[model samples]
Target: MTVKDLATLTPSGYPAVSLLMPTHRTPPDNQQDPIRLRNLLTETRRRLEADESVPADVAAAVYDEIAEAAAHVDLRQVGEGLALFASPGQVHVRLLETPVHERVVVADTYEIRDVVADAARRHRYWALVLSEQPTRLWSGDGSTLVEVTTHGFPFTHEGPGGTQGLPRDYGQNPSAHRDERHRQFFRDIVTGLTQVDALDTRPVFVLGVERYLAFFSAEWTAAIAGTVPGNYDHSGPHDLHRILAPHLAAYQAFEQIAALEHLDVARGANRYAAGLPEVWQLARQGRGAHLLVEEDYHSAAWIHDDHLHPAEQQPTSAPAGTLVDDAVDDVVELVARQGGDVTFVGDGSLATDGRVALILRY
Candidate 1:
């Protein structure tokens, strides 16, 4: 998805990201160092949570430092967090710990299916169901059929004279039926889409045949066009957890980016467009969670009060501003200090020209 779409998909109100790092602690060879290693982990978690913007590089550096400090400790085994991605809509949960040499073993092959089913049960919203069957019916809280169609042979056979015997009956094969079933499946989907369009929540996940996905895309593009804001995944089979995981991760990222971008845009409005008193008024009313400003006008001030008392009281060395400039800077700083996100846009860019929008009323 485009970065602009990412901004729009973010949920409006949230605080403090839930960072899940399910890792296997390798016990140090020296029995005496267990406490020390545990302390190191605790410190790492604290450091990560304390930062405002902790990028990947900063995390790596912090990890390296901690590892070096614990050199004397003999940590043998490492476990990877199987789910390391962010959620789709509201919460942006990231998996920090990476897997090492050992591969994660799923005791039962059907375990993935069970996980997906459980998630569907928990969140009854837009459940994107996926499957490998033709004309298979999914009857969950909000279920839809997905007919996967692939143009490939299911199996191969050999003839008596060292010649390959091709299956002449295409319609009888499960794969061949997928296409036909999928075409029929869209009728049900379009009905659901009509109902879903009127609702306020996100659309349910539907995983199924490749043909189903193709039909869904075309229908959505033609039917809703610019109205739908969120991104969806139609890839792979519907084993509850696997299908839902990536969407969940993406949802989480969208929210985080939205909150941050919104704050930036609000800050921009307060600074560069001081003539627009409505912008500052919105900020005061807590409606200014996000702001969009031109990237070139990064130096604009965010003023809050109409009077220039703050700038006037500054010493001679401080930068002087006209009454207008002071008023703008006051609003910009006010928004920034109050935890709003501001996004700087380049000139002629969508964001600079009002194409880059924010969700204030949501």
Candidate 2:
């Protein structure tokens, strides 16, 4: 399933169970996935039964839904990881390439923002390869590129040639004439893209040789601003992936820089928050406009009465009843449920010891 599918889920005021775990894409790993899933379901059942506050009927309903979800897991459809969400009368399982830590969360809402952000990073853009021959279009995440057909394109390159109903041949000034044609060609491409139902709001990255790229860049539209200067016209999908890595990396870096700029602006305006405690408070109150968490940062913590109790280390002496998992995961979920944005950034992006920061809506 897509991230959009995950985002549209509305809480039903009933218990929502979220299960995330590493699953196998291939054998050995794949072989053990069923066992892992079974184990998770067992844990989920135990948690539901142990929660004395949950109504028996509601707990049973949720558990049965979880079982139904587990029953449909096709090994062939599994990916490197798996995420399952279950609530009364609803269940969704998404296969993902990014591995998530093994965790089970039972709450009133689903913890899905991290997965949504991951999906965006991997598969949010369309790659348009501009060529004199067959102009190609691809839907891609950072890791994979799937070619998509654009009907009636490579317009001039195809049908007719020469003057009358034929391709034009600029005599001596072929270079200048061709340049102007390319300019107009790119303009038309921009217009076409705007009307394309498939393109939507996803960013477009144009790939072509230096000359064509220069021409396209001059007439660049906001819809298609990213241009990669290269010649990969004959490359297949695998080769295209390799070609795209550097460009995608550069794009993500640019996004990170922009996020930092926004954070700086928010801080200057006194509309920002830092560290876990403050960010958590804002998140609980739905005051978070944007949450920026350091990538690979996780703290064991749990919420009680809307307060975040964070533990720096797995304390030798712990509270009797505390839900300690990745606190950042809860932060992401809270921001997402409030319709706020969440961004996972590089280690030092926040420049704070807490490794969590927020841009407040107020």
Candidate 3:
């Protein structure tokens, strides 16, 4: 599910559960995942039975939802991971494009501590390689691009098309018969676009020769991300990625720069905070407006005496409060739950100050 979708869920009362686990679609690992999940469900069931505070009916209802969720999981369709959230009446199962850590929580509210990822939050754009013969559609997240399918636009010849085959008097008038045929070819592409789902909402980058690209501007239905000039008729995924990377990167990089600018303005106004401890505090208080975290940044820390303490400095015995796997993850969950935004910037972007920075809601 998208972060925005998760944000719309209003918290219900006790026994709200979040289950995060790694699942495999291939052999050996795939064989073990279901077994692991079954074990976790058994443990959760036992814990629910042992809790005398919960009414029998309520516990049963919660267990039924969890069990139902488990029943829906298909080993054959599994991805690298699974994220399951179950409240009393609500259940959400999101199959991630990337793997997340195996963790489970049975708490007063859903545990979304690890739900946010760059792939999950980033704008998914499609690269359309338009040609008269084999129009193609690709899905990308600014890094990896994959061709999903190909369609045929209106054209008779099998080889790559150009104006060479057009009739001699084609350019005589704007409304000439051959000119209308070319426009009809572009119109067919628009029809193909509508048939494929979600092409209208997501931004699309078009790659084609100058003439086709020029015509597609008026005929295309989707919001165009950008156009790269070339006929990528024989280009493979790697070639397409090489051509599209700089454009997508240049567009996506704006987020980090915008975040840094906001930080500077907020800092000058005494509305900004840096460092894990301060940011974590703001997150807990629901004061986060925007969070800027360095990519792959993590710190082992836990709460102690209502304050955050790095795991290393704490006593060997269990800490007094929550033991978080990573404080960064905790902040992400908190800020997102509060309807704030999170940005994962490149390393060294926040290195001079702190690995994490936040702008306050106040």
Candidate 4:
């Protein structure tokens, strides 16, 4: 979708922009007053609301103007006043004024690790995480982080003796090590997702190396089925960003589609045989939402006024193809004339569960 289309989907609750400022330079002596900072923010907000096409240059000018007035304020202190805004229908933006540092710790030895596992059994539930090292699993139900001990690996050692003792064999099989690492990763991520307050019962999306992807897909499918019972359904093996993009897009599309008055069809048993009449009725009434046809079914009979109007008219000698093909063509024509969407499905797929599900307007 175009950016304009996306803008139309913006939610109503959140602010359009967030400003973040970190503590760095001292505010100008006179600008140290909170009132001054508040006034600057007020001015900026006013300008933004007034200009339909506010550019970066204009924004910079506003900042400079504020800085000039707050001459006594340390620029660093002003920076800390910057706020983060979570825009509607947009990726959250955080303004950072201070440098954030990450610390790394290398374990002296390979050991079993315990990680938390949180499983969502809902069709829309999904979770994603990015990490370089294997993390310990913790309980996602509000308990403290649990350290799951690993049982199948050994840590490298290099001390004053220059690693003199007999070296413990990590593992003979490379695949085994990969499997263990992934198992821990999945567990930890699920735990983290469960801790998220916004997520209800929904399917989760997991992204990682190919090996982890395969392992998690298989294990998660089974785990969810066993845990939540009948609420799991998903499609993925994509990167975190890829998975999220589609979800956001689908949400937007769903919102737009929901706004329009439309018909929906659910196929029932004997759709191939019994559906012909309903299909014809829907077409005749100009209320067909979409024509759903099973690829495996064959026929050539045209349907009109709820009755099969065979091209040959002679029921005794007509080719079997005439019965099905004509019916499909008739349905297609009817739906198109009425401006409806058509979706064809494989014979055995879920789409064909019913003969022909016709979504109707009435």
Best by TM-score: 2
Model 1 alpha-carbon drift over 4 Å, by segment: 1-125, 130-181, 222-239, 271-362
lDDT per residue as tens, model 4, 240-328:
23445565345434533432223222322222222655566666677765555554443456433336654566354334323443355
* Pairwise TM-score winner, candidates 1 and 3: 3
Candidate 1: tens digits of C-alpha lDDT, residues 1-362: 11122223332222112222234554342343345446545655465545556555554544454344444323333223222111112222211133212122211111121122112122223443322222222222222223322222111112221133233565567444544444445545555544543442343444544544665666554322111222323332345444455664455345445644554665565432232345556555655445554333322233334323333353344354344332333334334444554443344443443432333643
Write the candidate numbers in order of decreasing TM-score: 2, 3, 1, 4
lDDT of 2 at 339: 72
Error of 2 at 59 (Å): 16
Enumerate clash totals for all models, in the order shown: 59, 7, 0, 63
TM-score of 2: 0.70
Q: Tell me the spans in candidate 4 whose CA falls farther than 4 Å from its real position.
A: 1-37, 40-127, 130-174, 197-206, 219-247, 254-362
Best by lDDT: 3
- lDDT-based ranking: 3, 2, 4, 1
lDDT of candidate 1 at residue 51, scale 0 to 100? 52
Cα lDDT tens digits, model 2, 1-362, are 33444555765756788998888778766888888889999999999888887888888998898788778878666566788888877877766776788889999888786577456335467777887666777777556566765644444443232122333455546556555666766777656655553535576778888877776667764655367788878888778777777777777777778888899999889999898877878888989888888877777775555566667433344444356566776677677767787667788777663788899999
Candidate lDDT (C-alpha), each: 0.36, 0.72, 0.74, 0.37
Q: Which TM-score value belongs to model 3?
A: 0.67
**Can you give the TM-score per candidate against the true fold?**
0.29, 0.70, 0.67, 0.25
Candidate 3 lDDT over residue span 121-174, tens digit each: 455677888776666777764454666654543233232134545445645653
